[model samples]
Target chain A: MSKKRLPNIIAVTLMFAMILLAGCAAQPSGDLEVFSWWTAGGEAEGLEAMLEVFAEQYPDIVVINATVAGGAGVDARAVLATRMQGGDPPGSFQVHAGHELIDTYVVADQMESITFLYEEEGWLDVYPPDLIEILSYDGEIWSVPVNIHRANVLWYNAGVFTEQGLTPPTTMDDFFAVAEVLEDGGIIPLSLGESWTVVHLFETVLLGSMGPDAYSGLWNGSTDWGSSQVTQALENFDRMLDYVNEDFAALSWDQATQLVIDGTAAMNIMGDWAEGYFKAQGWTPGIEFGWVASPGSSGAFDALSDSFGLPKDAPNRDAAIAWLRVCGSKEGQDAFNPIKGSIPAHTGGNRGLYDQYLQSAMDDFASDAIVPSLMHGAAASPSWQQDIIDAVALFLGGRDVSAFQAALVAAAGDAGY
Target chain B: MRINRDRLIAFLMILPSLVAIAVFVYGFIGWTARSSVSAWEGLLPDYTFTGLTNFIDLFNTPRFQIDIRNTAIFTVLFISTCLILGLVLAVLLDQRIRGEALFRNIYLFPMAISFIVTGVVWRWLLNPATSLERLSGLNLLFHQAGLDFLISKWYTHPSFGIVAIVIPATWQMSGFTMALYLAGIRSIPEELREAARVDGANELVIYRHIVMPMLKAITLSAVIILGHTSLKIFDLVMAITQEGGQGYSADVPALNMWYTTFRALRFGEGAAIAIVILLTVAVLIVPYLVYTFRSEVEA
Candidate 1:
């Protein structure tokens, strides 16, 4: 109340304000921040549904559904990285299962090894071994995958295919033959989207050309990127590029799928997420559209799983564990994946919950050999992945297959593969 | 004694901003400079001095090289087009034509919109899709107008994609440049123009000889403003042609820096890019500051 003490009060208040503004402020008790990029229709609803399960399990805890909206975690990952760098990580955050989770967080020492969670919950037996493999680094499990998305689905307009009396292409030769017929018939043979989707298509082409083993070999030291097989794959991607819509650069992945839906394009190489886009547009899976494994990639599942992990020093550690458990549990994944339009990461998920398309995906995911997706951050480090994206973007303009292959070789060398 | 007290009060009033700028501006800049030279990567900081390794590596990278080239093209085209277009619009408005305020608002409306919106709107207006089914923008207009030869791939053109970016940049900034030039033109004495007309100078000659030359300062300011924005463009490029068009044909250094630092967690390289951009802008601005200060002192 005294005039002389007023300056002291002001100075003390300023210091407190600065501290609060600098993110040292504590969170409210029982509050948890679950971070993700699932801001779109079904995926967002899917996340909400899983959170409802978590809510039922832990009614006392409050969940903050933090989201950053971008396709393929483009903007979200960057925001998450900065937040972690600032030492203000969310309680649990969505991350891709493999090299993305390892190289960005685990290797950087920002993530806790949730291997204990796996042990405590008996997840070691329930989750698929390959999914466990991708989630592990340095003998430690880093995250729990919620859903598995097949990244190599070749969805075609069934009407277009039937009109041409053609089955969906199952081999490289079949693809080109189908493409020629479609292109000659004035339909864009393949609908492609922007740069990242192009990278996605290129990944499937590589898998299709080389099969799962050789394609998987590209990421490890086993396969040579400059090998004749990769060269053939690059050539295939180049020729496929010629068959894509001329305005491919201007369209997003959904827009590309729309091209197939409207019958402007005959086929599209996209992830299973396109199935969600198709259904959202009122096109039924078996009726309006048909899907096959991308050419020559049959019996191989090119997989990318959207997983959630606990960061070190998370504010709500107990709540985060609860959240992770929900992410990995059979009850939660079945709730989430049915709405998310993807199959469950937990093999014990309810089979009847998924629809016609995801059931087939689940079958393929069970029987087929699994290879990691390059574009979705499983096969390579983010840096190396960016290099390939840039290389693909460049190759798109130039159509120089050898140059693209050389760039891939260089990128692999840089990644120390 | 009273005057000295007043001066002290003024200094005290400014002290907070001065100290804030010293810490937040120059201090952070210094911090960035230090971080750029560190061997940091992957969401963690390592200040082990790495010399010029980041800069050298960036220079050697093909993407960075393409970025520098794109920046060069963007800066030159953006500044030149903004200046010329701004000057022309200003001159046309100076004719005291009908609905001058209306035309002025129309020219300046794009400035009211952010670069993101401008980029988005222009993205639709200048779409490069050559296929009829996909062509709905400027290309479609060109087709309808029987100007098919003028229908370019715009930003999708491999070598000249950044040039297409200039159209949007100019669309957004030329209004600002026009306002500046219009102010410059209006500030020139009406009597001088009247005297020139009395001395038998034609309208074109009066503008070229008197009004245009007097806009030299405005031109310099416009160039610096437009040049720097073009140098470190991010949001506009992000909105339009995010994959850098095709093959990063429209990619700028700012976009690359963003991806490197935030996406790839190459903080050192990203900071190096930020510093490079700052230095390039400083190159454009430092001399202008010196000249303006010297002129103020002379005055």
Candidate 2:
């Protein structure tokens, strides 16, 4: 080859390489990347089942399961923030249904309004009106909620309860009575976990003490934070703390549930996900463990739903819309919720697929007065939720009830309550 | 002309790296400083100037106060323990003992691993309930051996949680400090020690007057490295204690910054924290850099 021809050949090769690299950098038009924090156990399985349904519907589209593993989507949120700020967004991402979606993504204008999709699919008729209200901002729905989790379920060892001749508590008085018996019998009355779980328990206690209407008012500025009822709730929480496991700070929610599973503790207040954890441990629902609507919250469902939304500049917009459609469908809900241990967000979900506990939860969800869960990001903004967590942490350390109430009020003010 | 051309070529060779550092490091820092003074509270970058509010709020928050206290406790304990233990180990190794390589390697192995790995391993080793007790039945052994007093609530201790974190931090870093001291000790001329001994100075006297003063520069370097690390410590705390570590007892500023920025979407507050950390590290490092540069020029 001639020397001049060599330079031309080198230029041609470089151009080809550049084109190949650019092609590699671009996402395939038919590929949908679903980002979430479900990386373990039943949650991961449920996500896979949903993806399988999506894949079956659209054989041409490839689904990318980009799961960032951490307890409560902590790491995944950080990754999503950076990616979105850097002008790259996944096709769709999992977010808690209410203010977590509204305040974090929608207010920031990072989420694309899926009101059109909802209208086209007639999702407004299927999903609960209250949940739709939570997902909407400025008269447009932003997300497609997959499943509803009841945050105020009190799970207990049924055998232990029957052996001790104690009934499931339905009120604070009943709870304390059962606690007294459990403590006298040398068993932990409540199996509390780390900070978030403690926060979760406090929210349930607040719900029980304040009741559903007053509890919802706490987030919406109608309920005075320093009111007598709020004070009573705080005191109730303090009393509940007295009966919790001493090693509560070191354990995760599941580990705390393990205490109940092994009959070391009498009860644990957690979401329906705890049921999934128990089933994963090979424990039957009614025989091995039992659940109530938590003490003083019998007729109330403390609700937090997990939903997926389209990002503003999703690379695969069509695929994402299709995914959302699948998410809201009855078939998808049945396939996902039975495995996820969460009740379907849609009222039309098949009840036969659910276990006994979920069937009851679904029933309660239909007839019961529903209240938002603060710890699970339904009642308040993410900033307010974090502030409450910090305040709760301080409350746990010092047990100063008045100071905690003051902090909550201040945090609410800061979050524009 | 040839010399000028050679200089130009040399400048061209370094231009890419200089530009890269300028844009990536210093430029980003400037941008962060700008963000720190802004009113950006949520996911969107507002950039409206609201000077010092975030910093003022940070100073007022009880959680931030706890972070400062934890950082102070962690820094003092981590550095002092590593230095003292490192010096002792270096001195012992300097005795020219048998199987010296094995001992040295064993001492330095923790340093070879990342802080994240060290954190995870120590998290299990120092767990109050499920770790050593459940796995090896060491707590049971202690109880049977009547050494139950040896067992305590390790990382779970409320007041001393940051101190527990310090143990893992020191474990990963002390080996590096030891290697530094060992090199410093070995580099001291044998003639100085010999002269001191000839003058009827004892071993202790020789070490105090001759060897210790000679190792001053090494100590300063170690302090600067360790101080900066302690100021910006994040991963070890995140892995071991996490955000809710025993009522936020183990929270440091870095962890606080991360939570504020990402979780809460309070970018302004997070940027202020970053600036505070940067200024703190700069307060320690800038003087040393200046001194080193001046000394190099003099030499």
Candidate 3:
């Protein structure tokens, strides 16, 4: 009798497994999953603070803060892709503002346009129109940007500058003059870090040399990459590299920032996260360290943002919309951006809550000629950025500016610029 | 009836694992292979038959070319250094030295920790390259030791940066190779050495003529193991250099494949790279598999 019942047991177990799989297909309506790469330091803390605000506002909805941490969304994007492709997108996810948002999700039709949400929240008056344009594609906006990170900040050691009787340079000619004085005085004029930082520095140089409109044209295909202006920018970048430390390839962005704080180098041109790093290391911003809108790009804001988008078929539609509302709200931006070390994407943020450097960043964001940053995910597709990275990497080794420019033109062509 | 029942039960026991391997392993491999030959460029899976376009593009690309060169240099350096050092260590240990167990444990400890862990530690030791004023890590140590001339730019060096990466790879893996060789050394019967000595052969001659010859199988195993690891090196290089060191100098095929697929979102190109890596590994492994199976059958 037991032997005959064995097949029956097997059939029952198979049926149970099928039932379990079927049961998992029905997601709970009260659950909202927010996926991101913010799993460390102030960024993580800021994410939690926003979540707290979200939780207080909606107590019934259970949020799963699903984070796969790697610096700058490297691992998180990979995980997000796998989930989105497998038809299991989270309720919401953090992404860079422009092309990363557009080329990855919007084009793939993974994200639902959040234009209705923006209008419902009355965000049109709060968010700058230009920023909204960055977040939109094909006449529809998708993601709600939370914080704007400025890419063209030139950070320097205030003590070193004071002792040398020098001020921060405002133009390309002024920069080289200052750089030369510091070099002659046995100081490395600039501190550059690894490859990506070089790209960051190069972008600032490009912006400063050509000004904002021409710089913006490089991405939109209006500016010819082989133009004399681009050549001048390349020559400037090559000159800028000469002022960097000999062992720059070994340092990271933070390490390079540390060079400024340590006064081993007078300057470091990096994103505003360098300010956060300095504060973490017990240096007060605008006192121990000083920042300028990287030389020649003073009147411009080279910006990238961390934004959240609602995916199609979200598990908790209402909760996800509520989450996005918080992401774009003045209160949410105030709570998040201060700790997150970025300026608020929403212009209505409380400036009094921010520090000195951040208040200045806010001022710059409000008034400066805003342009999308290529180093971060604003101006180009992910593939185009990789091409730039590879070209820059090769150029660093070879220092062939003409070849580098040619490569840029080729890359632009490939990207359909 | 008893025999039939026993066979059925045995089959039932292995059925789960067999099915899992078939579906998850072989099935995915087949899927990857199919995607590689298709024109799937973006997030959406378009399995339109594109036929080898991605492969052609990948080969023509300069970055991939650099990666292949870097991998070749890394493999040759990593394998040779590990084998020589491992054999040397094994020989030294076989001398019945005092604290032999202690030394052996210390040697094998690095292998126990992951390549990522080893890489994170080694990254600091090798970086901040060649600056006398800001020297730190091993570079600083070399400075104090009056070996300043010995200092080079570690993994940041343009021409030989991949060679610096090999140092860490060898440090992590040579211990395993040493363990294999040590076991091989111990297994070589004392009688054979005695007979060689009795025949007027010295210690050096015994090792060269008799002992080294006896460890041929062990060496082959070590080579096969280390060769495959060197060929598909990813995590260690990633943890250390992140972007395969400056100028694609330390890049491997696996690292390139990752960026192509995930970062750049070129699924077809990425899949093509994956198949290429698989083929490279197969070139190393299939012959070994065949040899091992044949040897087992003969035994």
Q: Point to the candidate with the largest DockQ.
A: 1
lDDT of 2 at A140: 93
> What is the fnat of model 1 with respect to the true interface contacts?
0.68
Which segments of model 2 are wrong by more than 4 Å?
A: A1-29, B129-145
Q: What digit string (tens of lDDT, one per residue) describes model 1 on residues A144-236? A: 999999999999999999999888999999999999999899999999988889999999999999998898888888999989999999988
- When candidate 3 is compared with the true two-chain complex, its DockQ is 0.44
Which residue pairs collide, candidate 2? Answer: none
Segments of candidate 1 deviating more than 4 angstroms: A1-29
lDDT of 2 by residue, A339-399 (tens): 8889999899888898999999999998888888888878888788889989998887678
Worst window of 10 by summed lDDT in candidate 1 chain A: A20-29
Per residue, candidate 1 scores C-alpha lDDT tens digits across B1-299 of 99999999999999999999999999999999999999887777899999999999999887888999999988888888889899999999999999999989999998888888888888889877886666778889989999989889999887778989888888888888889999999999999999999999999999889998899988888887888888879999999987688878889999999888877777899999999999998999999999999999999
The DockQ-based CAPRI class assigned to model 1 is acceptable
> What is residue A141's positional error in candidate 2, in angstroms?
2.0
Ranking by DockQ: 1, 3, 2
